[model samples]
Target: MEKERGYNMQIPEIQITKSWRKSISMSFDTQGVLQVRAPKFMLSGQIDNFLLKNSAWIDKNFQKITQRIKNKKKYLLWRELQNLETISDLEQYFKQEAKKYIIPRCNELAQKYWFTHAWIRITSAATRWGSCSSKKTLNFSYRLVMSPVECIDYVIIHELCHLRQMNHSTKFWKEVFSIMPSYKIYENHLKNEGWKYTL
Candidate 1:
Protein backbone atom coordinates (compact mmCIF):
# COMPACT_ATOMS: atom_id res chain seq x y z
CA MET A 1 0.00 0.00 0.00
CA GLU A 2 1.04 3.58 -0.55
CA LYS A 3 -0.02 6.92 0.90
CA GLU A 4 1.26 10.48 1.18
CA ARG A 5 1.41 12.21 4.55
CA GLY A 6 2.34 15.67 5.73
CA TYR A 7 5.14 15.52 8.26
CA ASN A 8 6.19 19.08 9.15
CA MET A 9 7.02 22.43 7.60
CA GLN A 10 10.63 21.46 6.84
CA ILE A 11 9.85 18.12 5.21
CA PRO A 12 6.46 19.00 3.72
CA GLU A 13 5.13 15.67 2.38
CA ILE A 14 6.50 12.12 2.52
CA GLN A 15 5.46 9.26 0.29
CA ILE A 16 5.18 6.09 2.35
CA THR A 17 5.20 2.63 0.83
CA LYS A 18 4.35 -0.44 2.92
CA SER A 19 5.23 -3.92 1.81
CA TRP A 20 6.31 -7.30 3.17
CA ARG A 21 9.71 -5.91 4.03
CA LYS A 22 10.78 -6.48 7.61
CA SER A 23 12.51 -3.18 8.21
CA ILE A 24 11.98 0.48 7.47
CA SER A 25 14.15 2.53 5.10
CA MET A 26 14.06 6.11 3.89
CA SER A 27 15.53 8.07 1.02
CA PHE A 28 14.95 11.18 -1.03
CA ASP A 29 13.83 11.09 -4.64
CA THR A 30 15.41 13.10 -7.46
CA GLN A 31 12.94 15.94 -6.86
CA GLY A 32 13.93 15.94 -3.18
CA VAL A 33 10.73 14.29 -2.07
CA LEU A 34 11.20 12.04 0.93
CA GLN A 35 10.23 8.39 0.47
CA VAL A 36 9.72 5.88 3.26
CA ARG A 37 9.38 2.12 2.97
CA ALA A 38 8.08 0.23 5.98
CA PRO A 39 6.80 -3.17 6.95
CA LYS A 40 3.23 -3.76 5.92
CA PHE A 41 2.14 -4.42 9.48
CA MET A 42 3.70 -1.24 10.89
CA LEU A 43 1.30 1.32 12.26
CA SER A 44 1.15 4.87 10.93
CA GLY A 45 1.99 6.16 14.40
CA GLN A 46 5.12 4.00 14.41
CA ILE A 47 6.17 5.46 11.08
CA ASP A 48 5.61 8.97 12.36
CA ASN A 49 7.81 8.26 15.36
CA PHE A 50 10.48 6.84 13.06
CA LEU A 51 10.44 9.97 10.98
CA LEU A 52 10.64 12.14 14.06
CA LYS A 53 13.63 10.18 15.30
CA ASN A 54 15.43 10.75 11.98
CA SER A 55 14.42 14.31 11.37
CA ALA A 56 17.98 15.57 11.58
CA TRP A 57 19.22 13.20 8.88
CA ILE A 58 16.27 14.14 6.68
CA ASP A 59 16.91 17.86 7.06
CA LYS A 60 20.62 17.55 6.23
CA ASN A 61 20.12 15.47 3.09
CA PHE A 62 17.17 17.62 1.94
CA GLN A 63 19.32 20.74 2.16
CA LYS A 64 22.08 19.06 0.10
CA ILE A 65 19.61 18.11 -2.62
CA THR A 66 18.15 21.60 -2.62
CA GLN A 67 21.55 23.18 -3.01
CA ARG A 68 22.48 20.77 -5.79
CA ILE A 69 19.33 21.67 -7.70
CA LYS A 70 20.00 25.39 -7.25
CA ASN A 71 23.61 25.01 -8.39
CA LYS A 72 22.58 23.09 -11.51
CA LYS A 73 20.27 25.93 -12.44
CA LYS A 74 23.19 28.35 -12.21
CA TYR A 75 25.65 26.07 -14.02
CA LEU A 76 26.84 27.60 -17.29
CA LEU A 77 27.05 24.34 -19.28
CA TRP A 78 23.74 23.14 -17.98
CA ARG A 79 22.20 26.43 -19.06
CA GLU A 80 23.84 26.21 -22.47
CA LEU A 81 22.51 22.66 -22.90
CA GLN A 82 18.96 23.99 -22.74
CA ASN A 83 19.21 24.81 -26.43
CA LEU A 84 19.62 21.12 -27.36
CA GLU A 85 16.47 19.32 -28.47
CA THR A 86 17.37 15.92 -26.98
CA ILE A 87 19.62 14.24 -24.41
CA SER A 88 21.28 12.38 -27.26
CA ASP A 89 22.37 15.65 -28.79
CA LEU A 90 23.77 16.80 -25.47
CA GLU A 91 25.70 13.53 -25.02
CA GLN A 92 27.09 13.73 -28.55
CA TYR A 93 28.26 17.26 -27.89
CA PHE A 94 30.00 16.16 -24.70
CA LYS A 95 31.71 13.26 -26.52
CA GLN A 96 32.90 15.55 -29.31
CA GLU A 97 34.26 18.10 -26.87
CA ALA A 98 35.87 15.48 -24.64
CA LYS A 99 37.61 13.87 -27.63
CA LYS A 100 38.73 17.24 -28.95
CA TYR A 101 40.13 18.46 -25.63
CA ILE A 102 40.75 15.58 -23.22
CA ILE A 103 42.46 13.12 -25.58
CA PRO A 104 45.06 15.60 -26.76
CA ARG A 105 45.54 17.05 -23.30
CA CYS A 106 45.98 13.58 -21.82
CA ASN A 107 48.57 12.76 -24.47
CA GLU A 108 50.45 15.98 -23.79
CA LEU A 109 50.51 15.38 -20.01
CA ALA A 110 51.56 11.75 -20.43
CA GLN A 111 54.57 12.82 -22.50
CA LYS A 112 55.49 15.66 -20.15
CA TYR A 113 55.36 13.39 -17.09
CA TRP A 114 56.89 10.29 -18.77
CA PHE A 115 53.79 8.24 -18.01
CA THR A 116 52.66 5.53 -20.42
CA HIS A 117 49.27 3.81 -20.54
CA ALA A 118 47.67 1.19 -22.78
CA TRP A 119 44.70 3.32 -23.86
CA ILE A 120 42.22 6.01 -22.80
CA ARG A 121 38.44 5.81 -22.92
CA ILE A 122 35.82 8.50 -22.34
CA THR A 123 32.55 7.56 -20.71
CA SER A 124 29.34 9.16 -19.42
CA ALA A 125 30.02 8.39 -15.78
CA ALA A 126 28.31 10.70 -13.27
CA THR A 127 29.72 9.44 -9.98
CA ARG A 128 33.44 9.73 -10.70
CA TRP A 129 35.79 11.87 -12.79
CA GLY A 130 38.13 9.11 -13.98
CA SER A 131 39.39 5.60 -13.37
CA CYS A 132 42.40 3.47 -14.34
CA SER A 133 42.03 -0.24 -14.88
CA SER A 134 44.49 -2.99 -14.03
CA LYS A 135 44.96 -3.41 -17.78
CA LYS A 136 46.47 0.11 -17.96
CA THR A 137 43.37 1.50 -19.64
CA LEU A 138 42.22 4.91 -18.36
CA ASN A 139 38.53 5.86 -18.33
CA PHE A 140 37.31 9.42 -17.90
CA SER A 141 33.89 10.98 -17.74
CA TYR A 142 32.85 13.06 -20.70
CA ARG A 143 31.34 15.48 -18.16
CA LEU A 144 34.89 16.37 -17.14
CA VAL A 145 34.90 18.89 -20.01
CA MET A 146 32.55 20.98 -17.91
CA SER A 147 35.35 21.65 -15.42
CA PRO A 148 38.07 24.26 -15.78
CA VAL A 149 41.19 23.44 -17.75
CA GLU A 150 43.27 23.12 -14.59
CA CYS A 151 40.76 20.74 -13.07
CA ILE A 152 40.80 18.72 -16.30
CA ASP A 153 44.60 18.52 -16.15
CA TYR A 154 44.42 17.48 -12.54
CA VAL A 155 42.17 14.55 -13.37
CA ILE A 156 44.42 13.59 -16.25
CA ILE A 157 47.51 13.70 -14.09
CA HIS A 158 45.74 11.79 -11.39
CA GLU A 159 44.88 8.98 -13.80
CA LEU A 160 48.34 9.01 -15.31
CA CYS A 161 49.85 8.72 -11.85
CA HIS A 162 47.64 5.72 -11.37
CA LEU A 163 49.63 3.94 -14.06
CA ARG A 164 52.58 4.03 -11.65
CA GLN A 165 50.69 3.64 -8.38
CA MET A 166 47.33 1.94 -8.88
CA ASN A 167 46.44 2.40 -5.23
CA HIS A 168 46.03 5.78 -3.51
CA SER A 169 48.86 5.05 -1.12
CA THR A 170 51.33 7.69 0.07
CA LYS A 171 53.47 6.85 -2.95
CA PHE A 172 50.54 7.59 -5.26
CA TRP A 173 50.08 11.06 -3.74
CA LYS A 174 53.81 11.64 -4.04
CA GLU A 175 53.61 10.83 -7.74
CA VAL A 176 50.70 13.23 -8.14
CA PHE A 177 52.44 16.00 -6.22
CA SER A 178 55.58 15.56 -8.28
CA ILE A 179 53.72 16.51 -11.48
CA MET A 180 51.26 19.12 -10.14
CA PRO A 181 52.25 20.76 -6.86
CA SER A 182 48.90 22.54 -6.60
CA TYR A 183 46.81 19.48 -7.40
CA LYS A 184 44.88 19.82 -4.14
CA ILE A 185 43.37 23.09 -5.35
CA TYR A 186 42.00 21.45 -8.47
CA GLU A 187 40.91 18.42 -6.44
CA ASN A 188 38.94 20.64 -4.10
CA HIS A 189 37.47 22.56 -7.02
CA LEU A 190 36.08 19.32 -8.42
CA LYS A 191 34.81 18.25 -5.03
CA ASN A 192 33.04 21.57 -4.50
CA GLU A 193 31.76 22.17 -8.05
CA GLY A 194 31.62 18.75 -9.76
CA TRP A 195 27.89 18.44 -9.13
CA LYS A 196 27.29 21.02 -11.82
CA TYR A 197 28.99 18.77 -14.41
CA THR A 198 26.03 16.43 -14.75
CA LEU A 199 23.56 16.34 -17.61
Candidate 2:
Protein backbone atom coordinates (compact mmCIF):
# COMPACT_ATOMS: atom_id res chain seq x y z
CA MET A 1 0.00 0.00 0.00
CA GLU A 2 1.42 3.38 -1.06
CA LYS A 3 0.54 6.45 1.01
CA GLU A 4 2.16 9.04 -1.25
CA ARG A 5 -0.23 11.76 -2.55
CA GLY A 6 0.93 12.12 -6.13
CA TYR A 7 -2.31 13.28 -7.71
CA ASN A 8 -3.11 17.01 -7.62
CA MET A 9 -6.43 16.39 -5.87
CA GLN A 10 -6.70 15.62 -2.18
CA ILE A 11 -7.71 11.96 -2.16
CA PRO A 12 -7.69 9.32 0.50
CA GLU A 13 -4.74 6.98 0.85
CA ILE A 14 -4.18 4.83 -2.24
CA GLN A 15 -3.54 1.12 -1.69
CA ILE A 16 -2.15 -0.70 -4.69
CA THR A 17 -2.24 -4.46 -5.04
CA LYS A 18 -0.12 -6.20 -7.67
CA SER A 19 -1.79 -9.16 -9.31
CA TRP A 20 -1.41 -11.34 -12.40
CA ARG A 21 -4.08 -9.37 -14.18
CA LYS A 22 -3.89 -7.57 -17.51
CA SER A 23 -5.34 -4.21 -16.49
CA ILE A 24 -5.42 -1.63 -13.74
CA SER A 25 -8.65 -1.03 -11.88
CA MET A 26 -9.47 1.22 -8.91
CA SER A 27 -12.34 1.51 -6.47
CA PHE A 28 -13.00 2.81 -2.99
CA ASP A 29 -13.30 0.60 0.06
CA THR A 30 -16.03 0.98 2.67
CA GLN A 31 -13.87 3.49 4.55
CA GLY A 32 -13.36 5.62 1.42
CA VAL A 33 -9.76 4.53 0.85
CA LEU A 34 -8.86 4.10 -2.79
CA GLN A 35 -7.87 0.51 -3.68
CA VAL A 36 -6.08 -0.13 -6.94
CA ARG A 37 -5.35 -3.51 -8.52
CA ALA A 38 -2.65 -3.57 -11.16
CA PRO A 39 -0.61 -6.06 -13.10
CA LYS A 40 2.31 -7.41 -11.07
CA PHE A 41 4.90 -6.02 -13.47
CA MET A 42 3.32 -2.58 -13.78
CA LEU A 43 5.66 0.27 -12.91
CA SER A 44 4.99 2.94 -10.32
CA GLY A 45 4.97 5.59 -13.03
CA GLN A 46 2.30 3.70 -14.97
CA ILE A 47 0.11 3.46 -11.89
CA ASP A 48 0.55 7.16 -11.20
CA ASN A 49 -0.44 7.93 -14.76
CA PHE A 50 -3.56 5.78 -14.38
CA LEU A 51 -4.52 7.64 -11.23
CA LEU A 52 -3.89 11.01 -12.88
CA LYS A 53 -6.02 10.10 -15.86
CA ASN A 54 -8.95 9.10 -13.68
CA SER A 55 -8.60 11.87 -11.13
CA ALA A 56 -11.95 13.48 -11.97
CA TRP A 57 -13.83 10.21 -11.54
CA ILE A 58 -12.01 9.55 -8.28
CA ASP A 59 -12.75 13.04 -6.98
CA LYS A 60 -16.46 12.76 -7.78
CA ASN A 61 -16.89 9.43 -6.06
CA PHE A 62 -14.72 10.46 -3.13
CA GLN A 63 -16.90 13.50 -2.50
CA LYS A 64 -20.00 11.35 -2.63
CA ILE A 65 -18.51 8.89 -0.11
CA THR A 66 -17.44 11.74 2.13
CA GLN A 67 -20.98 13.12 2.14
CA ARG A 68 -22.32 9.67 2.95
CA ILE A 69 -19.93 9.37 5.89
CA LYS A 70 -21.00 12.76 7.22
CA ASN A 71 -24.67 11.88 6.81
CA LYS A 72 -24.12 8.59 8.63
CA LYS A 73 -22.44 10.42 11.49
CA LYS A 74 -25.39 12.79 11.77
CA TYR A 75 -27.80 9.86 11.70
CA LEU A 76 -25.86 8.15 14.47
CA LEU A 77 -25.82 11.31 16.55
CA TRP A 78 -29.56 11.73 16.11
CA ARG A 79 -30.18 8.11 17.00
CA GLU A 80 -28.04 8.38 20.11
CA LEU A 81 -29.76 11.57 21.19
CA GLN A 82 -33.14 9.99 20.61
CA ASN A 83 -32.08 6.87 22.58
CA LEU A 84 -32.74 4.60 19.57
CA GLU A 85 -29.45 2.82 20.00
CA THR A 86 -30.09 -0.79 19.14
CA ILE A 87 -30.28 -2.40 15.69
CA SER A 88 -33.51 -4.13 16.75
CA ASP A 89 -35.00 -0.76 17.63
CA LEU A 90 -34.27 0.59 14.16
CA GLU A 91 -35.49 -2.60 12.52
CA GLN A 92 -38.75 -2.54 14.42
CA TYR A 93 -39.27 1.09 13.55
CA PHE A 94 -38.55 0.48 9.86
CA LYS A 95 -40.88 -2.50 9.77
CA GLN A 96 -43.63 -0.52 11.43
CA GLU A 97 -43.17 2.32 8.97
CA ALA A 98 -43.10 -0.05 6.02
CA LYS A 99 -46.23 -1.89 7.06
CA LYS A 100 -48.07 1.28 7.92
CA TYR A 101 -47.09 3.13 4.74
CA ILE A 102 -45.66 0.87 2.04
CA ILE A 103 -48.12 -2.00 2.30
CA PRO A 104 -51.20 0.18 2.05
CA ARG A 105 -49.66 2.22 -0.76
CA CYS A 106 -48.80 -0.97 -2.62
CA ASN A 107 -52.36 -2.16 -2.26
CA GLU A 108 -53.68 1.15 -3.49
CA LEU A 109 -51.48 1.11 -6.59
CA ALA A 110 -52.34 -2.50 -7.32
CA GLN A 111 -56.02 -1.77 -7.12
CA LYS A 112 -55.71 1.41 -9.19
CA TYR A 113 -53.72 -0.35 -11.89
CA TRP A 114 -55.69 -3.59 -11.82
CA PHE A 115 -52.60 -5.52 -10.71
CA THR A 116 -52.79 -8.57 -8.47
CA HIS A 117 -50.20 -10.22 -6.28
CA ALA A 118 -50.31 -13.28 -4.10
CA TRP A 119 -48.78 -11.46 -1.10
CA ILE A 120 -46.35 -8.82 0.10
CA ARG A 121 -43.41 -9.43 2.45
CA ILE A 122 -41.12 -6.91 4.09
CA THR A 123 -37.44 -7.90 4.31
CA SER A 124 -34.10 -6.57 5.53
CA ALA A 125 -32.67 -6.56 2.04
CA ALA A 126 -29.80 -4.14 1.51
CA THR A 127 -28.86 -4.50 -2.13
CA ARG A 128 -32.29 -4.24 -3.73
CA TRP A 129 -35.45 -2.28 -2.99
CA GLY A 130 -37.99 -4.87 -4.10
CA SER A 131 -38.49 -8.04 -6.08
CA CYS A 132 -41.37 -10.11 -7.39
CA SER A 133 -41.39 -13.86 -7.20
CA SER A 134 -42.76 -16.06 -9.95
CA LYS A 135 -45.61 -17.05 -7.65
CA LYS A 136 -46.76 -13.39 -7.61
CA THR A 137 -45.35 -12.66 -4.13
CA LEU A 138 -43.74 -9.25 -3.72
CA ASN A 139 -40.80 -8.72 -1.35
CA PHE A 140 -39.71 -5.23 -0.34
CA SER A 141 -36.84 -4.02 1.78
CA TYR A 142 -37.81 -2.45 5.06
CA ARG A 143 -35.00 0.02 4.40
CA LEU A 144 -37.04 1.39 1.52
CA VAL A 145 -39.18 3.28 3.96
CA MET A 146 -36.27 5.70 4.32
CA SER A 147 -36.47 6.75 0.68
CA PRO A 148 -38.78 9.44 -0.67
CA VAL A 149 -42.37 8.54 -1.38
CA GLU A 150 -41.92 8.80 -5.15
CA CYS A 151 -38.93 6.46 -5.06
CA ILE A 152 -40.88 4.07 -2.87
CA ASP A 153 -43.77 4.09 -5.32
CA TYR A 154 -41.31 3.52 -8.16
CA VAL A 155 -39.98 0.39 -6.48
CA ILE A 156 -43.47 -0.85 -5.76
CA ILE A 157 -44.62 -0.27 -9.30
CA HIS A 158 -41.41 -1.77 -10.65
CA GLU A 159 -41.99 -5.04 -8.83
CA LEU A 160 -45.66 -4.94 -9.67
CA CYS A 161 -44.77 -4.61 -13.32
CA HIS A 162 -42.63 -7.72 -12.92
CA LEU A 163 -45.73 -9.52 -11.79
CA ARG A 164 -46.90 -9.04 -15.34
CA GLN A 165 -43.55 -9.40 -17.09
CA MET A 166 -40.99 -11.48 -15.25
CA ASN A 167 -37.98 -9.99 -17.04
CA HIS A 168 -36.68 -6.45 -17.58
CA SER A 169 -37.58 -6.71 -21.18
CA THR A 170 -39.07 -3.87 -23.23
CA LYS A 171 -42.59 -4.95 -22.35
CA PHE A 172 -41.78 -4.84 -18.67
CA TRP A 173 -40.55 -1.27 -18.85
CA LYS A 174 -43.51 -0.39 -20.98
CA GLU A 175 -45.80 -1.57 -18.25
CA VAL A 176 -43.89 0.49 -15.69
CA PHE A 177 -44.07 3.55 -17.91
CA SER A 178 -47.72 3.08 -18.57
CA ILE A 179 -48.51 3.52 -14.89
CA MET A 180 -45.87 6.11 -13.98
CA PRO A 181 -44.69 8.31 -16.81
CA SER A 182 -42.04 9.89 -14.62
CA TYR A 183 -40.66 6.59 -13.39
CA LYS A 184 -37.17 7.25 -14.76
CA ILE A 185 -36.71 10.29 -12.54
CA TYR A 186 -37.54 8.25 -9.47
CA GLU A 187 -35.36 5.41 -10.67
CA ASN A 188 -32.44 7.78 -11.12
CA HIS A 189 -33.16 9.30 -7.71
CA LEU A 190 -32.87 5.88 -6.11
CA LYS A 191 -29.73 5.07 -8.07
CA ASN A 192 -28.07 8.27 -6.90
CA GLU A 193 -29.42 8.64 -3.35
CA GLY A 194 -30.50 5.19 -2.24
CA TRP A 195 -27.23 4.58 -0.39
CA LYS A 196 -28.47 6.86 2.35
CA TYR A 197 -31.45 4.57 2.92
CA THR A 198 -29.53 2.36 5.31
CA LEU A 199 -29.36 1.60 9.00
Candidate 3:
Protein backbone atom coordinates (compact mmCIF):
# COMPACT_ATOMS: atom_id res chain seq x y z
CA MET A 1 0.00 0.00 0.00
CA GLU A 2 2.92 2.32 0.65
CA LYS A 3 4.90 3.72 -2.24
CA GLU A 4 8.62 3.09 -2.47
CA ARG A 5 10.92 5.98 -1.69
CA GLY A 6 14.34 6.81 -3.15
CA TYR A 7 13.35 5.30 -6.48
CA ASN A 8 11.06 6.26 -9.32
CA MET A 9 8.76 3.53 -10.64
CA GLN A 10 7.89 4.66 -14.12
CA ILE A 11 7.62 1.38 -15.91
CA PRO A 12 6.02 2.13 -19.24
CA GLU A 13 3.29 -0.42 -19.84
CA ILE A 14 4.67 -2.74 -22.49
CA GLN A 15 2.42 -3.70 -25.39
CA ILE A 16 3.20 -7.11 -26.78
CA THR A 17 2.92 -7.47 -30.55
CA LYS A 18 5.41 -10.31 -31.00
CA SER A 19 4.87 -14.01 -30.54
CA TRP A 20 6.93 -16.39 -28.40
CA ARG A 21 6.91 -20.14 -28.83
CA LYS A 22 8.48 -20.81 -25.41
CA SER A 23 7.84 -20.08 -21.76
CA ILE A 24 8.21 -16.51 -20.49
CA SER A 25 9.64 -14.77 -17.43
CA MET A 26 8.32 -12.06 -15.13
CA SER A 27 9.42 -9.72 -12.36
CA PHE A 28 9.41 -6.25 -10.86
CA ASP A 29 12.19 -3.66 -10.81
CA THR A 30 13.96 -2.50 -7.68
CA GLN A 31 11.49 0.38 -7.50
CA GLY A 32 8.56 -2.05 -7.09
CA VAL A 33 7.22 -1.44 -10.58
CA LEU A 34 6.07 -4.62 -12.22
CA GLN A 35 7.31 -6.08 -15.49
CA VAL A 36 6.10 -9.27 -17.12
CA ARG A 37 7.55 -11.25 -20.00
CA ALA A 38 4.59 -13.00 -21.55
CA PRO A 39 3.65 -14.70 -24.76
CA LYS A 40 1.46 -12.95 -27.32
CA PHE A 41 -1.53 -15.05 -26.34
CA MET A 42 -1.21 -14.47 -22.58
CA LEU A 43 -3.98 -12.37 -21.14
CA SER A 44 -3.15 -9.01 -19.59
CA GLY A 45 -5.48 -9.77 -16.69
CA GLN A 46 -3.46 -12.88 -15.83
CA ILE A 47 -0.26 -10.85 -15.86
CA ASP A 48 -1.85 -8.30 -13.56
CA ASN A 49 -2.91 -11.00 -11.12
CA PHE A 50 0.56 -12.48 -11.17
CA LEU A 51 2.01 -9.12 -10.23
CA LEU A 52 -0.56 -8.69 -7.46
CA LYS A 53 0.23 -12.10 -6.04
CA ASN A 54 3.96 -11.29 -5.80
CA SER A 55 3.72 -7.84 -4.29
CA ALA A 56 5.63 -8.85 -1.16
CA TRP A 57 8.47 -10.42 -3.12
CA ILE A 58 8.48 -7.40 -5.36
CA ASP A 59 8.92 -5.16 -2.37
CA LYS A 60 11.67 -7.33 -0.88
CA ASN A 61 13.63 -7.64 -4.11
CA PHE A 62 13.23 -3.93 -4.68
CA GLN A 63 14.86 -3.25 -1.34
CA LYS A 64 17.53 -5.80 -2.14
CA ILE A 65 18.19 -4.08 -5.46
CA THR A 66 18.52 -0.75 -3.75
CA GLN A 67 20.98 -2.23 -1.27
CA ARG A 68 22.92 -3.73 -4.12
CA ILE A 69 23.28 -0.23 -5.49
CA LYS A 70 23.98 1.67 -2.27
CA ASN A 71 26.18 -0.83 -0.49
CA LYS A 72 29.10 -0.77 -2.95
CA LYS A 73 32.56 -0.68 -1.29
CA LYS A 74 35.87 0.98 -2.17
CA TYR A 75 39.37 -0.49 -1.83
CA LEU A 76 42.26 1.97 -1.35
CA LEU A 77 45.57 1.01 -2.89
CA TRP A 78 48.76 3.07 -3.19
CA ARG A 79 52.14 2.44 -1.69
CA GLU A 80 54.57 5.27 -0.91
CA LEU A 81 54.77 7.97 -3.56
CA GLN A 82 57.73 6.45 -5.29
CA ASN A 83 60.74 7.86 -7.14
CA LEU A 84 58.80 10.09 -9.52
CA GLU A 85 60.80 13.12 -8.51
CA THR A 86 59.64 14.89 -11.66
CA ILE A 87 56.18 15.21 -10.10
CA SER A 88 55.67 18.47 -8.22
CA ASP A 89 54.76 18.81 -4.55
CA LEU A 90 51.44 20.36 -5.57
CA GLU A 91 50.73 17.34 -7.77
CA GLN A 92 51.53 15.03 -4.89
CA TYR A 93 49.17 16.98 -2.68
CA PHE A 94 46.45 16.65 -5.27
CA LYS A 95 47.04 12.92 -5.45
CA GLN A 96 46.77 12.67 -1.70
CA GLU A 97 43.52 14.61 -1.58
CA ALA A 98 42.24 12.41 -4.37
CA LYS A 99 42.88 9.38 -2.22
CA LYS A 100 41.30 10.89 0.84
CA TYR A 101 38.23 12.71 -0.43
CA ILE A 102 37.35 10.33 -3.22
CA ILE A 103 37.08 7.31 -0.96
CA PRO A 104 34.74 8.82 1.62
CA ARG A 105 32.51 10.47 -0.95
CA CYS A 106 32.22 7.20 -2.85
CA ASN A 107 31.19 5.40 0.32
CA GLU A 108 28.51 7.99 1.02
CA LEU A 109 27.12 7.79 -2.49
CA ALA A 110 27.06 4.00 -2.30
CA GLN A 111 24.99 4.14 0.89
CA LYS A 112 22.57 6.61 -0.64
CA TYR A 113 21.73 4.15 -3.41
CA TRP A 114 21.72 1.02 -1.19
CA PHE A 115 24.91 -0.69 -2.46
CA THR A 116 27.15 -2.77 -0.20
CA HIS A 117 30.52 -4.30 -0.97
CA ALA A 118 33.80 -5.29 0.65
CA TRP A 119 36.56 -2.74 -0.12
CA ILE A 120 37.71 0.60 -1.61
CA ARG A 121 41.10 1.94 -2.79
CA ILE A 122 43.00 4.69 -4.60
CA THR A 123 45.87 4.33 -7.02
CA SER A 124 48.34 6.06 -9.39
CA ALA A 125 46.87 4.66 -12.55
CA ALA A 126 47.55 6.12 -16.00
CA THR A 127 44.92 4.97 -18.48
CA ARG A 128 42.27 3.87 -16.01
CA TRP A 129 40.31 6.51 -14.15
CA GLY A 130 38.99 3.74 -11.89
CA SER A 131 38.47 0.00 -11.72
CA CYS A 132 36.42 -2.58 -9.74
CA SER A 133 38.08 -5.94 -9.49
CA SER A 134 36.16 -9.19 -9.04
CA LYS A 135 37.51 -9.28 -5.50
CA LYS A 136 35.52 -6.07 -4.78
CA THR A 137 38.57 -3.85 -4.44
CA LEU A 138 37.76 -0.51 -6.03
CA ASN A 139 40.72 1.25 -7.63
CA PHE A 140 40.66 4.97 -8.40
CA SER A 141 43.24 6.90 -10.37
CA TYR A 142 45.36 9.40 -8.47
CA ARG A 143 44.97 11.64 -11.50
CA LEU A 144 41.40 12.25 -10.28
CA VAL A 145 42.86 15.06 -8.23
CA MET A 146 43.40 17.11 -11.37
CA SER A 147 39.64 17.48 -11.82
CA PRO A 148 37.08 19.29 -9.74
CA VAL A 149 35.61 17.65 -6.66
CA GLU A 150 32.47 16.79 -8.63
CA CYS A 151 34.41 15.06 -11.39
CA ILE A 152 36.45 13.05 -8.94
CA ASP A 153 33.35 11.91 -7.08
CA TYR A 154 31.78 10.86 -10.33
CA VAL A 155 34.72 8.63 -11.21
CA ILE A 156 34.89 7.22 -7.69
CA ILE A 157 31.20 6.38 -7.55
CA HIS A 158 31.35 4.96 -11.05
CA GLU A 159 34.04 2.50 -10.05
CA LEU A 160 32.33 1.65 -6.77
CA CYS A 161 29.21 0.74 -8.77
CA HIS A 162 31.17 -1.96 -10.54
CA LEU A 163 31.27 -3.87 -7.29
CA ARG A 164 27.64 -4.78 -7.88
CA GLN A 165 28.05 -5.09 -11.60
CA MET A 166 31.02 -6.22 -13.66
CA ASN A 167 30.08 -4.93 -17.13
CA HIS A 168 28.68 -1.76 -18.64
CA SER A 169 25.27 -3.29 -19.09
CA THR A 170 22.10 -1.24 -19.08
CA LYS A 171 21.42 -2.24 -15.48
CA PHE A 172 24.95 -1.17 -14.52
CA TRP A 173 24.52 2.25 -16.09
CA LYS A 174 21.08 2.45 -14.59
CA GLU A 175 22.57 1.93 -11.14
CA VAL A 176 25.30 4.48 -11.84
CA PHE A 177 22.91 7.04 -13.31
CA SER A 178 20.42 6.61 -10.50
CA ILE A 179 23.12 7.55 -8.01
CA MET A 180 24.55 10.52 -9.96
CA PRO A 181 22.37 12.19 -12.53
CA SER A 182 25.21 14.61 -13.20
CA TYR A 183 27.61 11.75 -13.92
CA LYS A 184 27.50 12.53 -17.64
CA ILE A 185 28.81 16.03 -17.08
CA TYR A 186 31.78 14.69 -15.17
CA GLU A 187 32.45 12.22 -17.97
CA ASN A 188 32.58 15.08 -20.47
CA HIS A 189 34.75 17.13 -18.15
CA LEU A 190 37.21 14.28 -18.04
CA LYS A 191 37.28 14.05 -21.85
CA ASN A 192 37.80 17.78 -22.42
CA GLU A 193 40.53 18.04 -19.82
CA GLY A 194 42.00 14.69 -20.77
CA TRP A 195 43.88 16.15 -23.75
CA LYS A 196 45.37 18.93 -21.61
CA TYR A 197 47.06 16.44 -19.31
CA THR A 198 50.26 14.63 -20.29
CA LEU A 199 48.69 11.23 -19.75
**Which is the leading candidate under lDDT?**
2
**Which pairs of residues collide in candidate 2?**
none
What RMSD does each model have against the real structure? 6.8, 6.3, 17.6
Candidate 2, 79-105: lDDT as tens digits: 678677755678889898898999999
Assess candidate 3 and give its TM-score to the true structure. 0.51
Window of ten residues with lowest summed lDDT in model 1? 4-13
lDDT on C-alpha atoms for all candidate structures? 0.88, 0.90, 0.67
TM-score for each candidate, following the candidate numbering: 0.72, 0.69, 0.51
- Which pairs clash in the backbone of model 1? none
lDDT for residue 137 in candidate 2, whole number 0-100? 96
Q: Write the per-residue lDDT of candidate 1 for residues 1-199, one digit (tens) a residue.
A: 6656555446535899999999999999877888999999999999999999999899889988877767776775556566654556778898888989999999998998898988889998989999999999999999999789999999999999999998999999999998899999999989998877776
Candidate 3 steric clashes: 20
lDDT of 3 by residue, 124-148 (tens): 7778788988887788877776567
Give candidate 3 misplaced runs (Cα > 4 Å).
1-91, 197-199
